[model samples]
Target: MNEPAQHMDVGAYALGVLDAAEAARFEEHLADCSRCAAELDSALGLTPLLADLKESAPDPGVLIARPRPALLDGLLARVVTVRRAQRTRRLCLAAAAGVLIVAGPLAGSSFTSQNAPSHSTVSAAKAMYEEGEKIGAVDPTTKVDASVSLQEKPWGTHVALKLANVRGPLTCDLVAVGRNGERQTVTTWAVPAAGYGLQGAGADKWSKEPLYTHGGAALNRNDIDRFEVRTLDGKLLDTIKV
Candidate 1:
């Protein structure tokens, strides 16, 4: 194969902004280029954290409403503080047009109802399942286990779900139900034959152990009365009362 000219595209390629032709060409080159491949690996390592930053951010409207008065003089200095604070916690990134929210070179963001990696996204969901306020249930009829985690934001809620004891191939959704009866889909995924969180599932089949999905809703946490785990065809599995 005639190799394309050796252009160092580790950064853009890592972030997946490369055009299809560029990505294809870079991928072919990557087959042999150890340095670029290694660099890509390191860059992809940030995907989880990046997804966390993007997924957990508060409402976008808040940012546009609060433009920085001293745009130039203080912006750069505030950036250092923001990064430092973000390293420690999710710093509510309102203003600066929510520059940090909309990713440009967004590496590894699957962005499906949303995702970054099959694993990394699930891992991030697991982290949210642990850290956020949560409620759960095991359905009597469906016998499916479901847990809903919620992190309240000014605009709405960030949602994560851990679903187990469910058999598939089945499609399922996490619906955030409001006190007024409004329903918003937080996230959805298809379950496989092996099912999730089945008894005796080995670490090797951990991916099938539980379905972890994350998404956001427009309803504030206080307004959400419950979460429903249901199928696309309207088969309800579990209802987690908040």
Candidate 2:
């Protein structure tokens, strides 16, 4: 599918309106397409609000033609209301996730399981430590501690990351580079403020998470030669050789 059509289907897929085959194809595409994944994530995150709107919204078939001004005003009001609700929900979710991350094992399991990571979390982290090659930050200004383990899975690479003594509200984009030099974005996420800790703190003091990126079916473990972490604007931050 072309980019435009793929983008268009993201909403349908998020709303669960796509048929089984179509949804499968889109998900396959989503594994490699970070842009569509981001859009779909946004739509899925707003699912509750979407459901509320669907339940409360009047059917167009039941509504008689109304004055143009009134119709326009009502539509604008609805849009504004939805936007406000979305912002509020996003803030709450972010705060909750941050709190869970900081509060340690007592609340960590539930949040980690729901978001990402699983029973394999510890093994993955250990594998990355013992086998993965260490990747250094390319930029002198940024403080990033990262490694990549290509042996963990046949499908994709696993990344162990730590951001320390750095400012927050920053985005970390993970890109996988093929042996042929083709690049595919694996994931992009915001590093929370609390993720960074004091310079002398132990690894446990710093927030460390294992990130998995399946660079689609085309790119496999052997195909990937390196992984990179960068800002959204394509600024080079760190690189790990497989």
Candidate 3:
């Protein structure tokens, strides 16, 4: 196949839309082509986003009494739209980060004398789940086991979460509830289908890494009373108390 044709198959291969034989051929090519391998990786990372969009998509019947587009076509269009939006967001975030870096020197001068206090705040923070807590089931039919750990920092709380048997591609939100009954969103993340388990069996799975939240409005370790794991649509999945 030509280079352009092979590149075009990357998205289809990543989405599992290609036939078995075609997919096998593409995989063989991917083994030797670094550029196509990178493309495949990028496409795979968007799987969860695409899945979330699929789940949240409005029902065609509810919109109008007319023929709906083919599922593949609809999915492809959604994927393109999401990719473009993601690119734009990344550019914006990069610009914002650049500003923070430029202003870091001025900000550091203000806190130069209080560096010890900031260090102490991080050192004083402890894991919220040092003692074992039961993982609550969000869906009655699905068995999910999860554990969360938090460490307090001067800026905000750092969270580590592990989940098993929770189906994907799902978007999860970590919410921190303060002593005053105020809620703060610590972070949100996407889990790919493979993260669920092999062949849908309940197996141990860990998150890619710890997520951090910061700012005055964010939750602090001492003020937080409980943590809840919820879906993007506000469905409660599990909870852990500090």
Q: Write the per-residue lDDT of candidate 2 for residues 1-242, one digit (tens) a residue.
A: 66677766765675565678888888888899998876666666645544444554477344332324444344435544665698899999999988754443324433555666655543333434455545544345565555444444555555544334444567777788889999887656665554543354443433443333222224767677877778797776677776
Q: Rank the candidates by lDDT, best first.
A: 1, 3, 2
Off by over 4 Å in 3: 1-142, 197-217
Weakest 10 consecutive residues of candidate 2 by summed lDDT: 208-217
Best by TM-score: 1
TM-score of every model? 0.49, 0.40, 0.37
TM-score-based ranking, best first? Answer: 1, 2, 3
Q: lDDT for every model?
A: 0.68, 0.57, 0.59
Mind giving the per-residue lDDT tens digits that candidate 1 earns over 1-242?
Answer: 24434335655565455678978888889999886676566555545443433444375433332223343224333433555575555444454335433221121123432544454443456767778987889999889989888898888999988888888889888898999999999887877666777775353343345667789999998999899988999999999999
Better of 1 and 2 by TM-score: 1
Best-fitting candidate, scored by lDDT: 1
Residue 201 CA error for candidate 1 (Å)?
8.3
Whole-model lDDT for model 3 versus the true structure? 0.59
Instruction: Please give the RMSD of candidate 1 to the true structure.
Output: 19.9
